[model samples]
Target: MNAGHQTTRRLAAGAGKSICRSCRDSLSRNYASAAAAAVQTEDHVSQHIPPVAQASPQTSYQVNAGVVLSRPPQITRDLHPFESAFFLYQRRLNERSALPFTRYFYYKERTPADREWKRKIKQRLTPARDIGRYKGYGEEAWNDEVLVGAKESDFNWQVERLLEDAETTGVEDQPAQELTETTPSPLAQKKVEHEAVERPMSRITEADKKNDVKSLNRLLQRTLYFLVKNKEGQWMFPQDGLQKETLKEAAHRVLEYSAGVNMNTWIVGNVPIGHYQLDYPTSRKTESGLNELGLKTFFMKARIMAGQANLKENQFGLQDFQWLAKEEVKTQVEDKYWRSIKNMLAER
Candidate 1:
């Protein structure tokens, strides 16, 4: 062949050698990897086998000792009395209660109609508020002892007024009767004394008195109130939870989270105005991992200095909010909870 043909054959030969070398290197790597895997498999089997099957008894002993030393020891200490009490309280709060450990509400002023409406509502419900089977003995006893007592006092005041009118009329007509018959015996004297003793005193009882004008005047300032609809659809004051926070912090956070009131627009009070217990449905025994059937909720109240409840799109499940008038609140809230709210609003 020619010189060019010879050169072409040499180049082809070099290419074939390079290809063969690459294939050899790949095969060698695969064999080395397979040998390493086989060795690992044997080691694994040896470790899992019984100690008697092992080559050396000392090796098994050493492996067991290493495992024991690798594990860390668990240590615990007993809590202090106060600390234990606090933990117990917190545990109860967790197991028996819903998320919100406390609540805060905002109250403005009240109108004249508001005060009047509250007073009338209280009067209407006072007689039978605790008469239902749902009420406990404590509530029944309180109603009988306190509310019934006040009613009796008012009745006595009216009787006293009637007695005063009778005494006056008797004195005026006594002269005419004296001319007709002059029978003044000790029996008649005793009867008169008896009538006097049975008659009501002229003084007015506390129950008969009205709300002072000054106190009512303070409430009659056309104050607007605010309430929020909870996840349950009950209308209540905007509230939030307390997570290891002070009452004020929790209140402000509640205003922000539930009411969606911006910090710049909203003004909040530092101190809480009132407090109350909120009744919530307890979780089922299976769900709560406890036998308790009730939840203990503690609520607090605070005054909204300024800003309206502008609930945002992502607010805490708050369906809606409103700047409610007194009449609106009376229609919205239940009687028992409203009494506490009315007291807060009508506070002097």
Candidate 2:
């Protein structure tokens, strides 16, 4: 019975081992098939797909230096008449104090209609009957004389009237010579002259020399306009009271001391466009430190003549010099100041 049992056990064990070996073989084959299929799929994909081309690092650096790095051209435009007038007047005025001032004229560019109109009217306009009257003067000469001589004469007349008024009580009254039989002392004469000068209504008369009158008149009439820049990149024309210097002296110093220009080379005209008043608040200390509401400023026009402005170190902290046209000035300057500038330009 024991021997039979052993035979049965052996047979059972052998069968179990064979079954296990078969299962192992099937698993190995399935794994091998799956790996082969995956390899095939990868190979097929790689053959069908194109390789991506990488961008070259060198191409981006191929910028043309000549084309991209050239300097920009300068932009400029024709100067306005005021600028030219300033130049001319400055040069002339510097040479002589009393200049025969005349309005500068420019030839208007005629349109097609204007040309046709002039052509039609040309034949109808008769030549002057009295040629002898215009014998010494051609059209150009006549125009020059009418503009220059007439203006000079008018200026002289105005100056004479002003001077006459300074000495006499009124035009209707007796002449100053008749009124005062005794010759006045030199000191009294000087006192009268000083009084007349201080009084705005007092006329500067013919008794005053042309140079003195011109200088004094310029001191009264001329305004010194200067452009200043601040740290924040804003622009302004700075002006202050005539602290110490005379008008002509101040004008020269404004260029020399403030603007740092070579005043010896640069010239300026005596005839200014006009004057305008500005008011502002101030701080005062009478009994106690207090804020005052009383400060006044008079701005007058001064035109540049010959040399360019060579800026210097100034208290106003100006960065650059500029000539703004009326239109540009109107946009940048304050309303009250712009109005003054506009009026001055209009006088041109």
TM-score of each: 0.31, 0.30
TM-score leader: 1
TM-score of 1: 0.31
Tell me the spans in candidate 1 whose CA falls farther than 4 Å from its real position.
Answer: 1-220, 261-271, 280-307
Clashing pairs in 2: 162-203, 162-204, 163-204, 163-205, 164-205, 223-300
Alpha carbon lDDT of each predicted model: 0.44, 0.40
Shift of residue 347 alpha carbon in model 1, Å: 7.3
TM value for model 2:
0.30
Off by over 4 Å in 2: 1-226, 230-234, 263-273, 281-294, 346-348
Clashing residue pairs in candidate 1, if any? none
Query: Candidate 2, residues 228-314: lDDT per residue as tens digits?
Result: 454456555544345565444444554454455542332234433345454333434333344433434333344444344455665
Output candidate 2 Cα RMSD.
26.3
